[model samples]
Target: MKNILNNVVSLIVVMIVLLLIIPLSPFFLDVMIILNIAVSLIILLVSMNIKEALEFSIFPSLLLITTLYRIGINISSTRSILSNSGTAGQVIQSMGDFVLQGNVVVGVIIFLIIVLVQFLVITKGAERVAEVAARFTLDAMPGKQMAIDADLGSGLITEDEAKERRYKIQKEADFYGSMDGATKIVKGDATMSLIITAVNFLGGCVIGMVQGTMGFTEVLQVYSIATIGDGLVSQIPALLISTATGMIVTRAVAEDSLNIDVTRQFGAQPKAIMIAGGVLAILIAIPGMPKFQLAVIALTMMLGGWYLLRRMEEFSRVPEPAMAPGGGMSPTDIEQMQMEDEENFKDINSVYDLLSVEPIEMEFGYSLIPLVDEASGGRMIDRIVIFRRQYAQEMGLVIPSIRLRDSSSLNTNQYVIKIKGEEVAKGEILVDYYLALEPPNLEKEIDGIDTIEPAYGIPSKWITVDKKEMAEIYGYTVIDPLSVMLTHLSETVKKHAHELLNRPEVVRLVENMKRQAPELVEELIPQLISYGNFQKILTNLLKEGIPIKDMETIMETIVDSSMTVRDLDSITENIRVALKRTITRKFCEGNSMRVVTLDAELEKTIITSLTNGDHGVYLALSPEVMQGVITQMTEEVRKFQELGQVPIILTSQVVRVHFYRLVEQFFPDVFVLSFNEISNNIQIQAVGNIAV
Candidate 1:
């Protein structure tokens, strides 16, 4: 499991300890669950990434415990109460009974659903806000201001995909009451686990309370009430359901999100797992089951299946293609397989066209030739010039008709004139045509005006009386089709490159690598060596303190141009590297949620430049909301910084309170931005990046 998920689990275990031992009024329990539900609902107001139904575990248990505590010694009566009344007792008992059954589990499920789906991303003054929070979270650790640690995991998201993901997260935030990019600010893995455990624990307690009251507390009495075979037969469905559920959960655990509680991905969704448990509940409730038969079947199925499934899932059962219950394969996978084995070409005609000439000739961000004068530039904008008798005749005022390319407005019309191998644009004026058609002034003997016009149906040829030199017949010429297309493709690729460079995650990853990866520098040497010698591009990343393995991976990825996280899993040797223990210590000490107002003076800029002035209040979420907040925040802040504009932020102390723990735990030398109050101005300063 990831550390964030783990910590969340730990927090949940602690809360459940409270839930188990504390003897609050049923009202207090109601209130606690309600408040949590409300907060969770707030998340639903935004676009949420994970569903929260996994929380049902708490309710079932809570029901059992509550029922046991309430019924005490009345086994038969409690069972009678549960079976009748159609989910609500008469008016007198309705309120009380409903609180136990209707309110707790249902309310929590509704609320958690809200939290999981809501997104509400906020960004105005987020950097300065997150910074102060980070500092406070770090506490009074020495030299923390200079340490910096960054993970290049996000660089694994392709530029286009990152933009899309960012958009989704941001739109979710927009649905909420804030507008900062909080997706990366507060780690969410821990928060999600917390929600799950809280919900599940409450659910389990409820289930235990309700069932135990119906003689479940004296389960031995139930077998005595009926035959062993009859009791065992009653729970066959529960047996299948529990086994299937356990099988699914066991399959889904993994070890990433380092320090978070998220299990690496197994195949099952949380809902599917919970439903599996629900199936068990429904199965156990089936009527007329014999005790011994039900027990034997359920026990056999649950124990044997659990063991087999656990081994299959946790140890060796690899992810197979997704399938339907009674099918050979799913539609998506079948389509994918078909595509993978597809023929290379449907028809082969032009072999040269098949080569990737466009990508080769015009790689993204690669430069096209520079031009001093656009008129003289090598752009072959071809023009067609048709010369007929009417235009020449009109120019000369001598013949009945001669046509020319520009008899009306030659001043603005340009032409593709081939000058050597390069193409140039030049005008063909009416004056040139005029000279060609000038009437023969043989009686007067003038320049070209002395030439004779050919007779009708005669070839206008062989006017060779000029002594020194005759004017060259010039118009326009065609340019190569392939080269023109290449130039156009190059321009488009460069445009896309600029957009990619500006991406928030890409900016931070590259900057971090530039600062911290020396070995990475050596790896990239191969890419540039063929460029023969190159100018060194010094960047902020050279400061260093990053782990050698991580640095190597970053360098290798950058050099190889990797585009996805799955690619990282395949290529990086140091997969699943543990996060430093220091993060655990630091983060544990700070407040969970940190809030700050935007700088009063530049509030407009904070709003306008970052979020179009639509954002007003800024609330940074709980550090427990996620595990990798610091690294993500660094990337976002770097994106803003790359814009060459500094964002207004809250004071430094608050930043430390929220994110310092992460800094000390994860970074080698973390770079920090500190905001302070100075007269009526917010003064921001760098707390030189620190090494974690």
Candidate 2:
């Protein structure tokens, strides 16, 4: 409403000036026209332009004023001068006197002349100025026609030159430069450029003239960066705009720590923000949009740059502060970033955030378990109870974290070992295991040496892997050398006898050894009966294809067969059920059906769907009907061949000639019950008789 009111008042005032003021005061009108035209033309010519001669912009207004002024002066001066003398001074004096006289038509004419001269001067100057700008910017940024590359390679250029090379190369590739160092991206295609340029030029010429004539210089200067008539008017506007934009950018982004952090979090660089802003600003200056304000574009772009900067800053970091120690707020600083970027920046952060952690249970030997701790140094084992739980939500890892998972606590849910009888079971099955005495150290580890190093010589690292080293390091009396001669005098031998103690004879023999070599028997018993060696031997034998199946079969028989449930038995049953399921699945998959009803009945129903005797596609069977038809097919195949054809019967018994004694043995009784019989079902006839 306000805009409408302002426009109405402005139009009414212009109307009053045209009707009452202009006609009554023609001398003032003439003076106003002459002054406006001259001022506009001078601005357009001297302004230099915004690199290109943007059409319908400030330049056109300036041009219009010049052209109108020139035409006006010519007509008015000639009218007065031609009325008497032909000389230059006489003409000037007469023209000046008539122009001072109250002639409204003469004033309009003077306005037209000034406008024409301004228009011509502007166009000529602007075109030259644009060409010069393009040339200079191109020359300054040229990678070619330079010895800089070779000089740098030879260490001739300074460090500054080397540093600048990267930026210069980028500039050369990415943008075009203006005199004020305004960089514009190479966007619009050639066809678009041509159309926009033409529209803009025509608009500039026409509107520049209108505004100039209407005495709207303030509007022209406010909107236009540079004009065709007067170059100086453009400077204030451009500088003011740049300063305004710069201030806006600072206000929006400077104190917003959250926005800045977001930018940092997302790995955004300063260069990226600057580039976005710069492109936006350039777009402001290049409004080739027809019938639009090409003049006010510079302002729009500056604001756009500030907007982009603000957004980019927001997405780069975590806005929330981390909790401090001692249950209090940390005296940490809000992380501030320089407007500039750093060296070697790739702009990515891994472990972007940790979403949550919760206790999880994993399946262990005989129970579901919650893991309290686990330790495996330098080993990576990701499982159900690991960070798989932690990362159920995305870690949003952009770059990999430098930290590795720490493993220092022992918290396995269970430690399970299987025990077998003297003759092992042929098939795997879980059973109650008898306690077995065994040496724990004979397991062949990569760092597992069978011989124990002296306590003083072995490093602590060895103790973790080697039990003997651990024992020696701890200085345990369990390592007595004289225990080798004893039967079961020491603890090691006593424990070794535990598995054999199920029988009375073995216990008596071990008891005798305990009485004999008390020291030696304790240390020696562990080396003889460990399951690790048996497992290794079993593994080797299986790999070598040795028959270990007999031993498993005998041992499996030793336990009550009802109590001895093997894993494979259940697995094999499942496999058989699975195979049965697959067979049923195959039959169920396709269009095969067992016939229980006559096809004639189905045909009748299908025929009723279409017009009498008129055939179209018919989905001729319901599921029950299809099953009935399949049954019929099976019956028909069985009946075929006293060689007739329902299928299976025709090929029921295939007799190929077998060779015996180098002679053809065409024994009809010799048959393989197979689909081979069906292939012999007579080549499918390729006609409908086999089955539709």
Candidate 3:
């Protein structure tokens, strides 16, 4: 039944077009004219009631159909008038008589004025707005798409929601583009109305004079009335539709219809209404004004203003609900409300809610909430998005979404970063100040609160906003509090990225890899190295800050060595050697790889402490020797820091793991490399030696 009705609407549209060639009787012409007026009225109402432009997305096509219908009506009526001796439909004839009131000149002028308004003002303005809208929507598509993808990647929106939003954006672009062309149709329709009206008047006069039915003056009066009437009847509906088009294109999206929005906005301020009433009262008292009429209007205005003010006062005076005896509510109302509240709480805050924890979490003090509040212009979320992409590109790791929340128990300036539900790092940042690091060549020290850079522990000071420029001019590195926190979070995530990669992520990686190199993954998985061991190797590499983006190389190395190397550590070491060029480039500065080599005696001592067992290699050195080694290594590391270089310790392949195990607890930032991990093509610059 619905389809049949839709087909009927389609048939009617076709018939409207065919009416341009087929002549119709006066009664049929009248009915079609009324139908055209009804449609224009409906369009105007719908346009006004829509909450958004897309709600009436088919309006552009409807505009074309309605314009054609109006033109066809005009053509049929003009034919009846010229051929049937100015005897057209009563609707057009009545409209002409009522508008002219026996004055042909006045009616003609009014008809032309309506056409001019529709063409020059409404249609033209709508066209320009649609053109601009279409252009901007097209231009912003790329950025909008990126934002949607970012939201999807961050898990802020589900895949289905993202797809729907993308489709809506494309639909909006297409709608506006169509409207840009639809406005031209309206302009042409208005232009044609003028031509048709002129032809009706002139041609009717010629026919009447040739038939010798009336004098020149009589012919002029009769035909002018008919022509002006026909033009007015058609132009009135055209004008309404043109107005609707303007309204739809220019309408801003709101929660309510046009009428409701207008009312709410205009009545929001009772004081303004009262002021208007006072002005109306003053105008009513003016001597030259119509005293009775002005007085009545002033009284109505004053009454409306008083009503609004009283309502506002009453609303403001509404008291909060009072508690019953014992600081509780009454048994009936309070108990029911309490029960509902408990049920709602249980629904959301159940044991199931505690089962999941974000891989990375950031808890900030209450005062730092503004840093993540988008409404307050906080860009921390955007910065995090950028950080994720940067991490993916540089480190070849997909960091999970960092859950941000506020903690009132924390101090006003403190923030804590957590990995897998355990706190790993904490820092304090002054929200309104900038941290300025002093350069070595600084002539004088700036006066501020001395502190350490949160990310790197470099000595710094928190300076006020006014001193930022002076600090920069003095070659001090200045950073805002948000950037400081972001940098710290990014570095922390990179350092602990291995813990974030679990079996599921590894499986996903494998599935993705299979798409590119099916044969390699198919042969290696479950045949050479199990999936568990594969994940272990990747995690081991990430633990040492090696990018696994070169998956082909990693897989090839594993497939080649896993047959003989069953020990996971030995396999990892072998893979590291396979990636010698990559590791060398990472640690090297240009052609020279500056490093600190362990002393021969210390290396031998560490090697002697190593024990091979069922689990893996173990290091067991005396506490005194370990302490002495840590002290010596700390001194060598400081020298590299003073030279503004990252410290890299080199050792023989056999003792590299043992030495790394011993020193990592003391200096986590130091890079320890085995001799086999360095490429022969690079120059080795031994800056210092770690001796004990």
Candidate 4:
């Protein structure tokens, strides 16, 4: 039975092919016509009921099969009409008698109109829509795939979920592309129906006339009904399939079926319905208007609108508490309400909730509340979400949700960003103005209040909306107030990203890695290096703005280095070498890198000053030497700044950690690279040599 069910479609297709070549009795022909109508109806209903196009992924193939079956039926009916004196079957004859009713011309005109509607209107529109949908779906594949990767990187989805999403995207692309070509088949079928109708009418007339069994008028009366009936039978099913094609292509991703969606949408707008009824009622005032019919329709519409409004009111109304004998609650009801209130307040005195601090928080004043309130069209939360996803993909660390609240103590326009409940950065925004950064070469001077761009501390002005275009034309970078706040929040989070990676987050990262390389995780974690040491290494890398996305290589480096040395600094340095490609990709400009290097004398001094203590390693340089080194490093970095490039300081692997700690307090943004940490293919150009 299972095998028979599996091959039913194949058997039906073979039978359809045979129908084109073989003759059929009237009874069998009637059955096939009825089946064709049933199948078309089923296809139409299925298309309307589906939630998404991929749910009906077999629609494209089914369209071809049904079209072939339809064409085969048309052939058999044509042969029967000409061979049996304009009588194809009982179904066709009844339809002809019903439509014609002694008026052949009207029936033919109606048939032609149906065919034109299917061919010109429905089929043509669906074809264009399918073509555009296919093109857009194909064009969006890269972005969709990138989004999946971002979600996977952020640990929002597992690998299996990511694969499923990717597969669905590809399937959607293929389905639309197939639909683009399948619509053409619908168009061709419509055209073929017309041709077959003409052949049935003309061929039946000639056969009857040549037989000398009827006059011209008699032949016309007999064949005209048959032709219209055959055309209607074939074209009605074709029309249904064509409409189904339009429905599937135009259907958006919706939760409900077509009927429910349409009804609910229309019912949601009582005011529109009432206004439409009023317009129709007013139409009765115009001359030559049918007052009675318009009055009936207008009354029905007004009643429907009133009913909808009443239903909405009922749903929105809150029920009042039932009154007891003395206009107060009964004893039982009072006890129940008191018990519910107690249940709700049970957690009020919990100290654990009070002591818990958010990893990050943003507090704003009341005047800047609109920038965070979604109800007021604020996008602070949305912008933060995008920043988190992008930062996760780039840095291999997912940012925890930043808590946002309005602080009454701050200035009206001021906002503070906090990490671990301590304020780290604060900025102010003008609700009604745009910030325009000053360009180096001013094209034209514009009037506005002077300010500094909060994110980067660049000289800027808060300009009104009317001056926005003028500012842009003058080569000033304009940003809105909300964007200014979001940019500040994003930068602050990145600067303190290392502080956010607690033990739990590290455990999450480990669990995620275990899925891909379980053996490595099982072998290296805790046995070779404790979790605290592993996290310290990661935190150190992030503190210097390095991504730990290459987890496998980091683990392998740790496993190898732990056998020889037990120092965290050496293990981290070795991991950095293993991640040279990542480092180069992050900091290098193509194959060439302009950097500041330490002179041999300075390197020897730093090596001599290096000391090993309980904390691990430190540079014990004197205050005078440290100040001179900082001054010289500042001068070299300024040279790179003059040429519009970021400063990078290169040193030997042994002195890299000590030197980084020395300059970290003074030059936080400067990158310190050791020779071993840079890829060999990159050409290094020493722009300056820092020495003391």
Candidate 5:
């Protein structure tokens, strides 16, 4: 029964089209005319009440269908009028007599005015709006798709939600595109109505005089009234539909309907209303004004303004309920007292919430809010998501979701990056400007605000967007604020990647490995070494910027050596030797590896200072010698950096860990590798040496 009922409208539309050829009686024609008016009114009301355009996505199709119906009605009425000389329907006769009032010229003029208004003003405006809307909606699709993907990648929204959002974007584009073409159909319908009305007047006059035995003047009078009435009946509905189309295309998405929004906005300012009332009163008091009519309108406006002000005052005077002394309260305060009672209820495990911290966080100033807001066309969050995926593939570590939020207390242009609840890096950027890095060996000076680049602290300047081309022409590296922030965030995450690894992450990594090599994981864990020791070995490698993507090699090496190696550092060294190829490839350039080697005497001294006990290996170097080693290492590292190479210190296996510990405090960015970790296939080049 429900399915049949749903198909009834389709059947009626088919019949409406068929009516273009079929003849209709006077009563049936009247009923169809009334039905057309009712449908048009309903459509207008629905268009006005909808909160969003999508809620009435089917409106374009309905517009086409209704236009067809109106044309079909015109055809049916034209057939009846020409054959019967204005005796088609009492409704048409009554309409013609009432509107024309025995004046054919006035009736025709009024009908032409209605047609001109719809075609020239309403239809043309709607068509242009629909065209522009379709173009913009289609253009915005890619950005909207990226936003959905970003939300899904960041875990801010579920997969289903992302799919739904994407579908909605596509639907919106389709709706506007259809409306663009559908508006043309409406314009064509208006043109056709004009032609049909003219045909009815001229054709009816010829038939009335030639066949109906009526004089020429009488024929003109009768046909003009009938033609104008017919045009009125059709064009009035067309005007309504056109207006509805305009409203649909121009409506902005809001929380309320059009009527409510207009009322709220217009009534928001009582002072404006009062001023308008005052101006009206002044005009009424002047001479030659309609005093009574102006006075009534002025009085109404003043009264409305006064009422609004009084209501606002009443709202302001409503006081918040305060707690009574000794927990005593009146009956009027029972609701507030009950709310307080609910607030006192606490869960037993609520304390666990305090123990959790985000692995990575970025707090941006209020000025940068648009960088993360998808609606504002900001792609920073999307770029961050892409960076996270790429960083994971390069570093072989699953970075946790970085929580982004706005900070009100920070400077408007500043942003802070944190890891494990501690601020690690912060920088300032101009939201509307671009950062242009100084080109290599360039002597030309550019006009801009001189500031250092936040990512790498290179010499850079903040330049206006219009100067971007000029900077690029000079071979300067231009980057947007979002890219600058992401670069800083990427480097900071890499530097602190070791800190992000914990027991849960370690377990997740092991579980991932078990899928590929179950026997290796089983043999390396519980039997030879504990999970905590293995995690520590991984952490130690990561601390020096090593990737553990070669899980098979690491697991096999650990399984082979864990039976004899009890110290975590010893196990780590053994694993590094097994991963010599990976480590060498990471730090070496092509077939040769450039390194800063320690002097033989200093190496021997470091080996002697290393003492092994129950706690682990410890470097017991004197303060004087440690200071000297740090000073020399800093100089060597600086030289490597100047040559555009990462600083890598190579030493023998026995003293490698101790040397790393000694230099790590002073040069945290340096890579410390043991001789055993260097692959024999790669050639070694000692670029510089550190002597103490």
Candidate 6:
């Protein structure tokens, strides 16, 4: 029985096709016709009850099968009717006699009307709707996927949720696209029903007359009723299915079934119902109008409307306020809410909530809240999400969720970005103004308040909306206030990203890499280096802006280096050389890299100053020599800035690490690379030589 049930659908489909070729008895034909109507009704109800279209993803295939079954039943009924002398079965005979009531012309006209309505009206509209829906769904897929990605990157959704949403999107597209073509099948079925009905009537008339078995008038009455009955039996179910097609295609993202939604929506409008009742009552004054009937309907509508209005008012009313002794209303909602909040805070377990800190946070002044509020048309959050996705793709680091809040302690235009709990960067943004950065070669001057760009410390001005275009025309880079704040936030996060790579994040990275290179992780982790040392190596690389996306190479380099050296710095340096291709792609513009190099004398001094200690390595240079080296390094870096290039200091492998640590505080933005860390295909040009 279970095996038969499992293959029931296939068995039924083959039977339906066989029914088309085999002759059916009247009783069996009636059973198939009734089942066709039942199946169509079930489809209709299911389509109406579904809240989303994907819930009925199999609807298109079901529609094709039902349509084929209906066609098969029509063929069988037509055979029974023609062969049995204008008699199919009890079902059709009963419907014919009931609808005709001895009027053949009227019954035939009604049958034609039903077929036309199904064909030209419902089926036509459903087909068009399905076509348009399929087109729009396909076009919007890329944008929807991007939104899911953005939400995932910003920590709004988990990976599993993203995959589920993407799967639903694809399923929805497939369903709609199938529906677009399936609707045409419904249209053809309606047409076929009409053609079969015509053939039955005309063929019966010709056969009865030629055989001289019945007169012309008798043939018309008998054949016309049987034809109308067969058509009605088939067309009724087709109409129901057609309406269902329209319903599913036109359905939006609804929260409830169609019946509930329609009821709730209609009940929400009492005024319209009352107005309609009034109009009906006024219509009773017309001549020859049915006054008594109109009065009953109008009174019913008016009373129902009044009852609905009272219920709506009762639900919407606020609680009565208690009176104070001073003739004032007792504590307002805000005060009540505050009291409730204080009551909750009294719980001992709630104290732990106060001690927890977000990994990344941004607090803005009250005036700047609009920049982060999506309801106010601000896209700062969206911009930040896009940056998060782009950064993760490029840097192989997932940034923690950045919390945003409004603070009353700060100035009205100021916003502060914090890592863990301490403030790292702060800036001001004028809500109604744009920040225009001054170009080095200015063509003209624009009127605005002078300021500095927070992200890069470039000279800029806060200009009103009216001056934005002019400022752009004058060779100034103009940005909105929200964008200004977003840039400041992005740069701040990038600068402190290394500090944000905590233990939990490192574990997640290792687990992610383990999926791709399981052996590498198993051999290197806890075997050659512990998790803490692995994190330290990654942090050291990130501190200098090197991407750890190629985790396999990093782990392989670590494993090889662990054989010779136990120092984390040495392992990191080896990994850097292994990631030379990624570094070259990031910093170098083309085959040739223009950089600043240390003089041979300065390089020798730096190598000599490097001393090995328990902490791995350190540079022990005198303050006098350090000061001279900084001054000369500063001058050489300035030359790169003049030429509009990032300051890169290329040195030998031994001096690169210690030299970067020596000048890191003064030149945090500068890039320090060893000759071995650069790819051999790229040519190096020494634009300036730093010497002490």
* Residue-wise C-alpha lDDT for candidate 3, range 177-212, written one tens digit per residue: 998899999989989998999999999999999985
| Shift in Å, residue 689, candidate 5 | 9.2
Model 2 per-residue lDDT tens digits across residues 1-692: 98978698456445434432222223543453345444544453333222222211233232333333333333332222222221113323344344535443454355335443333343233334444544655674533323354344334677588667656544432322231122110111112222332333344345545544434443233112111111111222222222222222122123334345455543445455446546555555554643244334544554555666677688776666565676655555222223123321334342333432211111122211212122322112222212222321222111111112222232231221112212111111111111111233423332321333122111212222235554544442232221111111121211222232223333333344567654433533343322333333323222211222232222222222324443222222222222332322322224331211223344354334333234322243355644554555445434432232212211111111101100112221111111221212222221111221
- Over the stretch 200-230, how does candidate 5's per-residue lDDT look in tens digits? 9989988998889888889988888788888
lDDT against true structure, model 3: 0.87
Query: Residue 64 of model 3: what lDDT?
Result: 88
Predicted candidate 6 versus true structure: per-residue lDDT over 29-88, tens digit per residue: 889888888988999999899888888888898888989998898888888877888889
For candidate 4, the TM-score is 0.80
Model 4 steric clash total: 0
Score each candidate by Cα lDDT: 0.31, 0.30, 0.87, 0.90, 0.86, 0.89
Best by TM-score: 6
lDDT of 3 at 684: 92
Residue 533 C-alpha lDDT in model 6: 87
Which residue pairs in candidate 3 collide?
Answer: none
Clash pairs of candidate 4? none
Candidates in order, TM-scores: namely: 0.16, 0.17, 0.72, 0.80, 0.74, 0.83
Runs of candidate 2 with Cα error greater than 4 angstroms are 1-37, 49-58, 84-692
Give the per-residue Cα lDDT of candidate 3 at 361: 95
Off by over 4 Å in 6: 1-3, 80-84, 150-158, 211-213, 270-275, 305-352, 361-386, 404-418, 421-489, 513-534, 552-567, 610-628, 642-644
| Error of model 1, residue 611, in angstroms | 68
Clashing pairs in 5: none
lDDT of 1 by residue, 558-677 (tens): 455433432222222211112122212222223221222223332332223322124332334344533444545566455534443322223243332123333434542233322321
Candidate 6 lDDT trough over 10 residues, lowest sum: 325-334
